[model samples]
Target: MLPRIFVVVLDGLTAMHPSPRIDRLYLAGTLVATSLLTACAVGPDFTRPTPPTATRYSPESRPDHAAPTMAGDAPSQTLRIGDRISAQWWEQFRSPDLDRLVRRSFQANPTIDAAVASLRQARYNTTAQEGFFFPTIQASYAPSRTKLSGNTGGNSPGIQGNGSVISTVSNTPASQGGTAPFNEAVIYNWHSATLTVGYVPDVFGANRRLVESLQAQSEFQGYQLEAAYLTLASNVVAAAIQEASTRDQIRTVQALIDSSERALKVLREQFRLGYAMRIDVAAQELALAQAQQSLPPLEKQLEQTRDLIRVLAGTTPDQDLNEHFTMASLTLPAELPLSLPSELVSQRPDILSAEAQLHAASAQVGVAIAARIPQFSINSTLGGNASEFSQMFWPSGKLFSLTGNVAQTLFDGGTLKARQRAAEEGLNQAQAMYRSTVLTAFQNVADTLHAIHADAHTHAAAERAVTAARVSFELTEQQYRLGYVSYLTLLTAEQNYQQARLSLIQAQASRLGDSVALFQALGGGWWNRGREQRAEAAPK
Candidate 1:
């Protein structure tokens, strides 16, 4: 294919000359010779590795649907195998604030910008490498003035006293009383214009293999960019979930503190009336202090989480976001998409990127093999030279030359063979890395599946505990007011309710977070990113 293009280019260059027939025949012969030389490439071609044949990600049997929990109307998630995930999978949470934050991060994040720049750089480098397939044509003009010394042996038309031709050469210096030659120190302008064309035929396909390697590198960078997008979106979702969980925790602690303060006021009134001991008031005071102590850490955590979200959205810490998340605001998706093991290799960007690296390494081996063989090149120049610029293009001053060269290294101390071995080793390394990435991806899915299953049951149990604790605390408080139960028993019931509430909140948040991880591990639906979205993301 490349040879046909080269032939057309050579034909075009020949067309610029006056003798169309002879020039066409000359270029045709040259093209035939070079095309025969580039017939075969020297090394291994790359093939994609086979996908794993396993049907499921985990060794142990897992339930398709997680146990139903009391959080958010008892929403239970079922694994829908072979379902198509949306490109914007984060929207499954049904939070408009989260959707806006993710979209904004895609536009503003520095990591994403860097990845896009890298992809463009790789594409440009590949284009530069492809230019080697054609010949290099250059046009140059040089005009200069030069003078010749008198002592050199030369002759010119000159007048002599005895009608003999005079010589323009002298052995004696002009300062030594000798007559200066007529042409001595004479200056003249020399003008030359040349069009040179050079081509190194891909005799062993070295240039072809080099171009193939660069193309594979560009493909690798493209996958890297996709991976960056997937990572950023996942991070934003997880961070928002964290913020909601912390806020809930802080709110729970504050409610507990207020209840404790009211109980302490009743104990002080009883002690002033001599109906309660001083120890009872001190114990209530300690419980109130403990509840207050928990609030500061939760507040600190909320502030730090807010800062992280700001940075993820590509803004400074002082720049606050208009959107905020709460447990009530985010919905738990009821259906989660699950991909088969066979499709994982094709879906994951890290795996694809690794495969591209292996391809480049394979092409490098071809380049090294070609290096051990002979290289061929042809150069031609058509131009004219004259003493005056006006006559530079005249037929009398025409110049033409065609040269062909062949080069082969006699010996290089086995350097070429060593490089070939190194390239093969690199191929081996990339293959191993690809396998490792596949294993890690499978592990991620398996772990998230296990977490989703366990989190549902944990949240359900916490809900039951909170219900019992709330009933027990209410009964104990009424009994203490009626003088039928001690103050210590009421305090213990309240403490149990506080712990149960916090546990329920954490369990609920885990379910949401693990759902996001499952989507990320399944490749985040990057392949489904449609043409419209791509066009929107492209540089204007």
Candidate 2:
């Protein structure tokens, strides 16, 4: 019987043990493999949202297909400044001042700094999430001395007399493996040291999914930073253009003032010669005063625009931008590039960010669903122990153990199911938001295009009106001097002429501003220098 028992024990040492926990892990792994490779994901996977049905603005019309062309003749579709706008669109204005200011803004703007910080934060987060893929190992040591009760056999051995021993009690002594009676206390001393290693692999790929989700988030932020950069570029360019427009208007008004003063002098001479009424001179004087009043406001506006650019460029507003950079004249591009709405989606960083967010939401659904599956952890502890401190490393004193645990939330009262549903809802919401953003972007581009075109026409008509008014004013002054017109009539013509000139100046500025708005709406000119910087700084 003893030989058979020994043989059985030896056989057990060579045989494998069946573990239900390991079987479950294998089964879950199989499920994950099949799902990732073959099964369609349950939640929405991101697809780029479509833009508008019409590529161009509804009210805006292209030039006639058969318009005559010449080598030096400009295209009607093109802006006056150039044929195609570069990624650094502001440079097309050919202003060194603008280039320098934009560069300074890119470097010093607080918003840009914040965006860079956020990008760094996302990189750190990615690194932290990656650590989950690796295992953890640790070491520990413990030493202890234990004192047994005095009734045990450590101090004094039990004594028995041949006749005094109870008959019921066995006379034989207890062996090492058997229960025994002893008279003295027993004591024990031991030391333990261990190195433990453990890991819970991504058996269901839940951890991998989580990392994917984080990567998507990181990408989303990257796109957001791009969007911010684009916005900042647009702001600086627009501000510079605005400042130029205001200064030009101030100059135009001053010219108007000079013309009005000349007319006023003629009116005063006529009044002194009894050919014009005192009221005529007084009215002309008032017109001149009003024109003079206009200059201060335009000058104020110009200064304000300069200050805005300075702030955006991360410089003191008191700094002289004009001294460092000349305002580039507002020159229209010769031909505006019309991008198909479908392609426009790729151009806007905000839209790309939205798409990335949708992807993250999709991955989150997988993460939530994975929680319902079993988790497997492999654990081991190798240790040394000894009865005496000095002999702690002896073979007989060494001890070790290996352990494994598989945990699954068998029942969670529908909590996991709800989480998955929430993730699905989130994905749907993101998709909806992405679609909405695209539609809105299309609307902006279209509206801005129409406005720019319409303003151009308006400004042209205003120019003609101002010219006609000036001619009428000159003729009326002659008539008044020759006593062919009344003072009141001259006053009426003078007022009309001044108002028309003022209107022309305002219309010019408005048209220039519309050009800026159109470029902003198109999200143009943000890629070149910004892309260069990105390339230079990108991680190796």
Candidate 3:
């Protein structure tokens, strides 16, 4: 059993011996018994707030409320309107480097690690709050040697009675230049040890209210972790896709430059043979220079994008990841995940985290309101003291005391009220922020959807342009061979065809990038059971 001590000190108050009031407080009939009885807590409970009714910016013209179903074995053979994105969505691209980079980011990203640490800290705080519900114990010990002068104040019974007086000094001697009395000296030694235990019982549940706030904060931290995970994955995927697009553009431009240089070479030979005018040769040379100029900028962009992918994949600044990262091998997805407006509320981690913040603010408001109530505390002590250490446990020397204190703030200049008002305003601010986040998420999804649709048409048009330019160039070549048209005419057709090809590649890349953006807007396929299981199996 734990030891307890309760010492109540009332300043400048004297006690009369064996009084009825003292007897009622110490040896009381029922007050002492009731004080030791168990107690329960009382406070407001927690309930989740209701979310907004409509999940979309606008209403759907037609409704299909049934859950999505799968039919065919292969995804491409049966593309449905509501098929969820695969957990390993990037795997569909068939890029091994992308797969490895995403997994490394999940394990080694500093931002994700910071979020995880914050969650663990919140969990520890919750554990600490839980410890308050149990009892507490403490032990103390003090030993000292003392000397007393027999003829000093110790000799006066009225001022030095055993139960009536408490003194800080051990004794005073009357021997040195004594005014009225003889002197004598005595010495004594004493030792003592004590143990104490106490608990607040959470009788009014103020402690529980504080703990509830902490738990809500912990849940908020969990939402932070989820949001961080999504952000890291999205960044890595976007960078990789952008790099792939850059690589494609670089190849397209290089081909155009080669064709332009060949035309310029042929035109120079014609000028030397006196068959082509100087003006025509000059035009070919200018075209070649323009095409050559475009290559360096595109190559630089491709290099920068590749380096960005390397950084997102958790590589050092000086590390060369270009050898391990190649864009030519990636396969672009033909389609993206279909998302319903209603699912956005739960699917987007950042929005969910904002909602959690709102909930925490609401709880803090309750805590602020609870602060206006009265406070109560109980303390106690049980021990014995005697002149002889061996007799300290005797019935006559046994001692115990119980104390209860209650306080209420009568006047604080309305500080508490101002704090309550501040908390209420904070809750309102959080609500507005949550609503804003929801709207932003909706807008993001709508924009991505529009781009993907538009880029598809653009890509098709560019493909047609390339085909027509190629046909035109082939016919012009035949004309040049038959001496019906000049070589300059043939070069013009070839140049148009080359430009068309580069434009087609750019359109293709844009379409693929917009597809990835759409999936990211809908919170598609970053974290799921498959990735979680894979991470668990990985070496720590």
Cα lDDT tens digits, model 3, 344-413, are 7777776777777777777677667767766655554555555457645455444555566656788899
Candidate 1 per-residue C-alpha lDDT over 194-214 given as tens digits, one digit per residue, 9 for 90 to 100:
988788888888988999999
Off by over 4 Å in 1: 1-27, 61-74, 151-178, 181-183, 264-286, 474-492, 531-540
What would the TM-scores of all predictions be? 0.86, 0.71, 0.77
Q: Rate the local accuracy (lDDT) of all candidates.
A: 0.82, 0.65, 0.65
Comparing 1 with 2 on TM-score, the higher-scoring candidate is 1
Scored against the true structure, residue 166 in model 1 reaches a CA lDDT of 36
lDDT of 3: 0.65
Q: Regarding TM-score, does 1 or 3 come out ahead?
A: 1
Candidate 1 similarity to native, TM-score: 0.86
Best-fitting candidate, scored by lDDT: 1
Please tell me which model should have the higher lDDT, number 1 or number 3.
1
Deviation from native of the Cα of residue 432 in model 1, angstroms:
0.5
